[model samples]
Target: MRTVEEHQAVVTGLLAPLPVEDVPLAAAAGRVVATDLPALVSLPGFANSAMDGYAARHAEVGTASEAAPVRLPVGADIPAGRTDVPPLLPGTVHRIMTGAPLPEGADVVVPVERTDGATDVVTITGAPDVGTHLRHAGEDIRAGDLALPAGTALGAAQLGLAAAVGYASVPVRRRPRVLVLSTGSELVEPGRPLQPGQIYESNSVLLAAAVADAGGDARTLHFVPDDVDQFLTTVRAELAGADLLVTSGGVSAGAYEVVKDAFRGLGTVEFAKVAMQPGGPQGAGTVDGVPVVTLPGNPVSSFVSFEVFVRPALRRALGHTSPDRLRTTARLTTALRSPAGRRQFLRGRFDGEVVTQVGGPGSHLVAHLARANCLVVVPEDVTELPAGAEVVVVLIEGALQ
Candidate 1:
């Protein structure tokens, strides 16, 4: 039997960083930046107004107040996006709107609310200090400055920043393509009425979603029959275009274990029992030069195996700086037991300070897994823990109930 860390290393070592490609900013969201992106233009580009007001020299409008109002002629109206802004005259103000470029020789802005709201000649009721309501060029970021560093995950704000820095497309690592297959002759598709001893297939759906959530492009080939020759043929046909092959079921020491039987003949994939609960039966290797990771058939086992092994590997392949889930410690709300010499990952709901077990340590508890936000990790040497014992927890994003 292999330790969890040993198996994880074997699985993770199979994949390398994917090749980089340039994708449009619209399609770059959730992708990792391949290289440092520098700003093409300074943020703001030029001096502009931060508010709708009259732009003038502070010396002219500094003393204007409601008690002693000052009257000035408005030279030109400047709205946002007006490129050819006229200069402010010696004794005149420009009616500038928010985000409009500041006219040459203008140093201050008197808000429209503090003015008489006139076009030709406006009465100023208050005076703002020099540089008020002005956005200087390069205030946010200077031209040629680093806008986003390598390995940065692109999100809405990151994409917006890239666009603001004049990047229509960004270099990012290509998403790994995973071909998912679930085997078993007794499995039937959902929405189809089940005959005796036949169950609806769910591992393909579960594994495919998990692959996508880990930044991989997943394609599921559902319900391959339990014949070793047929399974091998089916997998080989679709193996050409996939970076990885992820399959669930038929790997255990059972009579009808087609995946184990077929892959053992190839002499590439290695099947082993990982020293971990819910997902002890694990296998990792390659099939015809493509990486393969075989997970157990149980719903929770498949999910946990993907989380513990495949998710991090897929993210690392996609160029993510942090490939693993967020881990922290929380006190257990109740006592828990684990089999000695086997690491246990129990589904739990963590409320920042404390974690409560969602259900018993059963691999088939899919509903319990659905209600869990974290995995309460019990080490291989640990047999039991008292209530209030601090335990390690791995937070699964979007898994909260």
Candidate 2:
């Protein structure tokens, strides 16, 4: 039996970044960059006004104050969008609107609150430091600078940053295609009639959503019956265009183990009764030249294994630079024990300072997963842990709600 770290290493080692594609900037959120995005042009493309005010030379308004103001003839009325205006002449002020391009030879800007409102003759009553209330050219971003690093997962801020640097489209990674299969004869799809010995085939839906959440293009195939040749036929046909294949329920030890039976001759399925509870029955290897992984049937077991193994792999394959789950140590609020030979993962709610179990440790407790934010990691070779002992936990979710 492999240790938790051993299996985790196996999973992480199989991940590599996917290929890149040029996509529009509007649709680049949550996508990864396959190439460096360098700034082509400067932000604030040209010198512009930061406020709705008069653009003037500070020397023209020498000692301009409320008691004795300096008045100059308005040379040019520059609104926000006008680009054909001439430069501000000496001894004159330009009535510049917010975001208006700064006229040449303008060294200062005075807001309307400090000046009398007039389109022809502008009176300045306040004193401002030179170069104040003005946005210089390339002040925010410069040309030929590193806009974003490679392998960056582009978010709203990143897309906006790239757009600010004049990028209409970005080079991003394409989302990986996935086929999620749920195999079981005792399963039925949701919103359908369930006869005796049948439950909703939710694993496929759950895993498919999880795959999409991890940045993959996933399609679910549920309720594949426990038939060998028929299942093999489906696997052969449906595995097209998928970067990775995932299946549930047929990998575990049982009489109707379709995945375990069907993939015996085609590929190497090294079964591992891992040194971990709930998700112990795990298998991973190539299936006819493609990487396929099998997770246990139970919802909690499958979800836990996905967090512990598959999600990181998919994130990596989708171009996540650092694809590992965050782990932290916290004081336990409840006493718990684990089997001597298998590491146990307990669902729990974790504050930054402490962790408390959501419910008792059980492989089938699906409800506890809703209220928990992380899994309290209990390793093998330990039987009991008293309350208040510090234990390591994998942060499945952050900032518990």
Candidate 3:
């Protein structure tokens, strides 16, 4: 059996990133930028006030103090968003509001509170330093400077910056569309009574959420029946323009593994019982030229498969620079054991740098997987871990516990 790393590479190699397209700034959030952005105009595009104050000349207010106040007429009042305003009159101050463009010939703005305002005759009891509270044009960003770089993951701040640079829309990679499938004869949908030897097929919903979390636009298709011909027909018929296909169950070692049976003769497949517990027997191949990632039948296995393999592929397709999940080494709060030959991924909750096992390592434990925020990683060589032992963990959802 191949190691987890080998199988991961095989899946990633088969799934390539999609092309880029133009999207509005609001819609660009969470999407990767496809083009470099240049500042159409300077950041402070014009000389504006950084604070609500009086714009004045340093020379006029040089000796303004409590004992000898320099009284000047309020020549012009500039409010925020005022683009065109006359320059300040000689020997006078400009009453400027915060974010307002500074009137010409005004070197500094003394906050209104700092001055004694009485009618038009304002006494500047405090002398502001040279250029105090003045925001110079292009100081924050120069015209023609690199505004936003390519491959940037657009967020609220990036969206604001892009709009400030006159880009109503940005070039961003389109989010890949994914179709998720779940297979098995012993599986039933939620809200139904479970018969003997039957359970709800939950990994479809869970994996779909994971795909959405990984930045892919995902949809869960109807469960594929366990019959080989039925499964193949449903897969072929429902596989529209999906950039990727994710399947759970029917790929394991059970006798009636319909997914494996249906795709057995089809070429372009890599079957690997990887060296990882909770998610070991898996497959990755192309069906009808669309990339398909087959995860193990178990719930924890499906979640781990998405984290270890599918997430990177989805991120890459969306043009993200860092396409893999983050790995953190943490101290285990409790002891655990792993299979002698397989690398174990224990469901865990991480607080700060400490990872406490959420439960023991079992592939079919869905409730434990649901409560876990992280996966404690155990190397294939080591079989046991004592309490407080350090282990590497992969964060899948939510903040560290």
**Candidate 3 residue pairs in backbone clash:** 350-401, 351-401
TM-score of each: 0.96, 0.92, 0.95
Tell me the tens digit of each residue's lDDT in model 2 across 1-401. 78777887676665556787899988888888888888989987888888888999888885899999999999989999897979888888999999999999998889888898799998889858998888888887789989888878888898889888888988877897878988878888788998988888778877887887788889887667689999988788887777778888777777879988898767576677778887998888777666788889888888888888899888887777876778999999878888898888999888899999897777678778878898898878888999999999888753338
- Reference-based TM-score, model 2: 0.92
Question: Candidates sorted by TM-score, descending order?
Answer: 1, 3, 2
Per-residue lDDT over 39-79 for candidate 1, one digit per residue giving the tens place of the 0 to 100 score = 99999899999999899999999999889999999999999
Per-residue error (Å), model 1, residue 363: 0.3
Q: How many clashes in each structure?
A: 0, 0, 2
RMSD of each: 1.4, 2.3, 1.7
Which lDDT values do the candidates have, in the order given? 0.94, 0.83, 0.83
- Distance (Å) between predicted and true CA of 329, model 2? 4.4
Give me the overall lDDT of model 2: 0.83
